[model samples]
Target: MIKHTPKQQELQNLQQHLLTTLHRLCPVSNGAAPPPPGEWPTTRQLAESNDITIYQARNLLLNLAGRGKVLVTPGPVNKSLRWYPSL
Candidate 1:
């Protein structure tokens, strides 16, 4: 079995929580068809789901995206970000 440091474990927990939140927010999961690329939960909404601050949620999102567990794309308008679950 693999072992994890306390920080690593904590980060893993955060990643799982974020993924669950994204799944819950997915359009298809809401009894709708799949959404366009820009349809995703806002950073604020995600933060609220996880009970974390926006800045902290942003950092966690970036970290997850870097690891390919999540996907980050440009919004429909500005260069702002849109977050999605990659799993």
Candidate 2:
């Protein structure tokens, strides 16, 4: 079986918590899902809304994207990345 270091486990826990919080705060929790091709908020906005650091938000979203739980798209102009839940 695969093994996870202590830090890895801690990060995983944090990611789960963040995702749970996101689901609760967003429309996804109320059966009013976000638009399929709607615009997603920036990492900074997510961080602010979730009361977490930008780095933490970015890490959590990136982890979700890596797992195919979310979608990551390149932003126009500045070329930054934006994330959306896979709902």
- Per-candidate Cα lDDT values, in order, are 0.77, 0.69
Return the TM-score for candidate 2, rounded to 2 decimals.
0.62
What TM-score, computed on C-alpha atoms, does each candidate reach? 0.73, 0.62
RMSD of each: 3.4, 3.7
Clashes of each: 0, 0
lDDT of 1 by residue, 1-66 (tens): 999999989878987898889878873454454466666677877988999888878898999888
Candidate 2: tens digits of C-alpha lDDT, residues 1-87: 989999999788777766666555454545566653335556776787767898888888888988988766655324445566667
Model 1 Cα displacement at 34 (Å)?
A: 5.6
| Candidate 1 Cα lDDT to native | 0.77
Could you tell me which 10 consecutive residues in candidate 2 have the lowest summed lDDT? 74-83
Stretches off by above 4 angstroms in model 1 are: 27-34, 75-80
Q: lDDT winner among the candidates?
A: 1
Top candidate on TM-score is: 1
